[model samples]
Target: MLIGQYFQEKILSSVKCTDKGSAYAKFEWLFGKGLVTSNGQLWKDDRKLLGPSFKLQKLTGFLPYFNKHSKTLVEILTKFQHQATNVYPQLVRATMDFISESAFVQDSTYQINDEDNFLAATHMALTSFRLRLAKPWLAITPKIWDLFGLGKQDKICSQFVNQAMSEAIEKRKIALAQEQKSSSETGENHANQKAFIDVLLDSKSEKEIIGHIMTIFGAAFETTASAMNYTLFLLALNPSAQEKVHFELDSIFGGDKNRDVTLNDLSGMKYLEMCIKEALRVCPPVPVMVRKAQEDIPLDNGQIVPKGCRVVILIREILRDQEHYPDPEVFNPDRFLPDECAARHPFAYIPFAAGQRNCLGMKYALMQMKTCLAHILRRFHVSTSQKRDDISLINGMVMEPKPKLEIVLTPK
Candidate 1:
């Protein structure tokens, strides 16, 4: 790739990301001027405005929602026990419902497998965007894809997403207005119990509110679902690893399949956390991250990434590099033990990226992953017919296992 001597120094923390780049613009079709796609002052302001919602304390408030949905997911998947079933769709539905409740304070019926909902339209839009990004020439002038009818369905998907989100935003606005009026009349403020949508409504326009809601929905649901899918897939193929995970879950839950996963419980899941990290290392949700160079970056080998150049940080490649991770292809959770991780390059494992511009919802996503796995692994033993090397992968905003991941779950 580069001068071998400078390999370790190239990815240092000093290189700042300029912008999110063009691939993310496809998201603007639905998330108009929202957090993930914006840059400069707009992005900074939006990040500050929304940062507190994802803070650890606030995320604890979402545990009940995550646990409730995780139970629903387990119940639904119970119907498929002992049979090879693709759990990806069910995972997506569960996460979508969870996000809907957390972000909008509304219960989405998608968990009931209703495929005609707005959340379903969001899934369609993401597929279209991924397709658009695949064709470099066509994506350069995105409207050309529309001309070839490739974007017709995407257009319809966008319409569905926008219409649905807009209506939700309007309803939230009316509800907030009424609540505020009543609060003023009664001289009692309910500021302590405001929902995320309520906070966004105070500062953002209707379109911007819808945009950020979609941004959170699009990013959170799919990526978390993919991460969980890969984690389960890896555990299925490795019986020993699955047994270890079960051991940890059993030790923690103590036969309480329905117990709520507390912050302390999640913190104590050292080995399960390792398995999750290794899964992310082997198959990061977003494999390649793009950043525009704001300033020229000098390499130890004398090459310079000139200012304004588009820099592609291959996250999957980095995680797989043998120099950083010995026996990189292996699914060994032992590699993430504290001392082992401390010995490696800090940048070796960045499933969520690094620096100031990293994922804002990092804590929230991790909590969901840990909580959902706690619920499922405690109640069932997972098994599969696929091998790690034989699994097919597709490139999108998130990496997906192709041919669908079919696995069987047996009650513990």
Candidate 2:
């Protein structure tokens, strides 16, 4: 069986799925009825409530915040030129700060340049839990090697992340409570005072807010980081594209000054935008998405995916299909120059996935990515440390470049 299909079949086993149970009855509570893990009325309601955030108007409000954090990224990467530091890690930190600052009104934080590396530990713990959650049968046929105890490993990492996230939530709650109290007395509260979290808190219960934050991070951080990483990798490999990106930036905003590029300026950087889109097409951060059939659904192939059947959508495959993209393997930005991308199915290029379960923070994620790339290309030139023969991809919940992508940065 193919890697994707094998995983699906394992999720569709008979014991847990015996018709009465939902296709995704397990882990349903953890992920909740937001995107990526919900079904029926709850799923649709969550989708509708979150829809307003992705609209163009809402995204425009995030620019000032994006500009603030993208500058932090530039300062951090400014160090990469003299030292062969892993620039990817810096990008990860940059995106984290961007989200933490922008996602809530109360938490306007800057990078202490923590480089906490909490995420790495958290990833290990979560992956272990996910492995166990995905493959419960392992407990049935236990081996001593397995007893090397991922349990303890999980608890340690989980403790670190849980502490950090819990602290953030607690701080946010206290700040909001204070803000609300002040608003009541002064009666001078501004409408813009509410952030993304406030809107969710208003519309949904507190428990739902917790789930939304968890889902947002799970979908947001790694994807934006990967996008930034691939972008640098591509720029490093193809100096011409890198130069073109800078030229586009210069043409719109000029080469000498450091001014906040507006939506109009952002729109003018068409070529650079195309380059980002192509990079996403070739190496989408979330290359595939898995869903469980809510109920029996029929496919065009005359086969029925029963109620409990697990469905894996191979977004990468669909993107690279030669029939859809005539020269599928080529990394040409011109392919996304409106005429071409507009011709393809929206679902065909599923970078963020699609439908009711599409990524909720899609607008915010794109805003962060575009701002970072636009700012960086204008400031520094990116290139790989050594020539690479092939650009192979790493598979995980979010696909990342394998074998540490090292790039050189010189003043542009």
- Candidate 1 per-residue lDDT, tens place, 1-412, comes to 2222134335435535547766678778878888788877798889888887877777787888888899999999899999988899899988887888777666666888566558668767877777767765666665887677867777787788878888777777787788889999999976544667877876878788888988888778989999999899889989999898888888888878888889889998999989999999998989877776667778666878777776677788888888778798899999999999999877677788776577888888889999998998988899988777677777677887877888898998
Which candidate achieves the best lDDT against the true structure? 1
Q: Give me candidate 1's TM-score against the actual structure.
A: 0.91
lDDT tens digits by residue: candidate 2, 1-412: 1223223333333223222123333333334554555555666677777767666776777788788778877877787775445677677667767766666643443355345545555466447645655566653433632576755665576566556655666777788888879989999764543566666866776556656765666667767888878877877788787788888888888675367868898778788878877888878887765565556655445666677555666778777878667777667788887888788756566687654445667667766788888888778877666544555676666685667777787787
Clashing pairs in 1: none
Off by over 4 Å in 1: 1-16, 113-115, 140-143, 174-194
Candidate 2, residue 208: the lDDT equals: 65
- The TM-scores, one per candidate, come to 0.91, 0.81
